[model samples]
Target: MGYVLRVRMASFFAGAATASCIGLSVLYKDYKTPHESISLQAKAFHDSLDTRISTLESLRQSEAPQLPQTTTD
Candidate 1:
């Protein structure tokens, strides 16, 4: 009876450990998917923002007002 109880306890612990490992692996995999997607989205947004800033700079340069300069002798 003692031997049987020990074996049952060992089996139960082994099963629990296996389940925990699998759960952690699945969670890690799920975490990576969203992280990659968010990284890609952020990269795309940064690129578009850079393009917009460049365009706005060019427009500002072209439309800027020029002041007249006076010459002194």
Candidate 2:
């Protein structure tokens, strides 16, 4: 009788662990963005940053003040 009880308890624990694993896997899939989506998002962000940086550089160059050089005779 004791051996049978032990076996049943072990079986119950095993089932619970399996269920937990499956639940976690499903939740992870649902909550996490796919790698491809993340990659595309990051690429778009960097592209926008690049465009802003280029515009700023061009504006800086256009607005730069020219200094006159004095020649000593």
Candidate 3:
């Protein structure tokens, strides 16, 4: 009975280790892709947004009305 229990425990540990390795490998593969990560996507979005904001700011500045100065006598 003791031998059987030891074998069962060993088998369980082996299975768990295998499952963990496979899961880690899958995760590594997924994270290896640039677009697969949320952080990368968020960074790309933030960069694009920054670009758009700068463009809009430049356009607004260009279109703004200039006030003329009056000379006092």
Candidate 4:
């Protein structure tokens, strides 16, 4: 009957929605990372960049000056 078909369709939709919600919940729970780990990684990256910048700055500061030379015209 038409009524039975409608009930079956409604049930299928309800089950699908429930499964979707559960799948999302599990995904969020499994993929959550601690803030401390993120902060540590960021700090390490910042320190490395700082070291590189300082080395480059020191190299620039210590470069030899160019000398004037006579050129053939």
Highest-lDDT candidate = 1
Weakest lDDT window of 10 consecutive positions for candidate 3: 31-40
What is the Cα-based lDDT of residue 59 in candidate 3?
100
lDDT of 4 by residue, 1-73 (tens): 9999999999999999999999999887666655567888999999999999999998988896767998999
Q: What is the TM-score of each candidate against the true structure?
A: 0.83, 0.61, 0.51, 0.47
Task: List candidate 2 stretches off by more than 4 Å.
Answer: 34-43, 63-65
Each model's total of backbone clashes: 0, 0, 0, 0
lDDT of 2 by residue, 4-60 (tens): 999999999999999999999998887676866898999999999999999999999
lDDT, candidates in the order shown: 0.99, 0.94, 0.93, 0.90
Best by TM-score: 1
Model 4 clash pairs? none
A best-first ranking of the candidates according to their lDDT comes to 1, 2, 3, 4
Q: Report clash pairs, candidate 3.
A: none
Clashing pairs in 1: none
| Residue 6 accuracy (lDDT) in model 3 | 100
How much is 14 displaced in model 1, in angstroms?
Answer: 0.9
Cα deviation at 10, candidate 2, in Å, is 1.1
Error of 3 at 66 (Å): 0.7
TM-score for candidate 1, residues paired by index? 0.83
Better of 2 and 4 by lDDT: 2
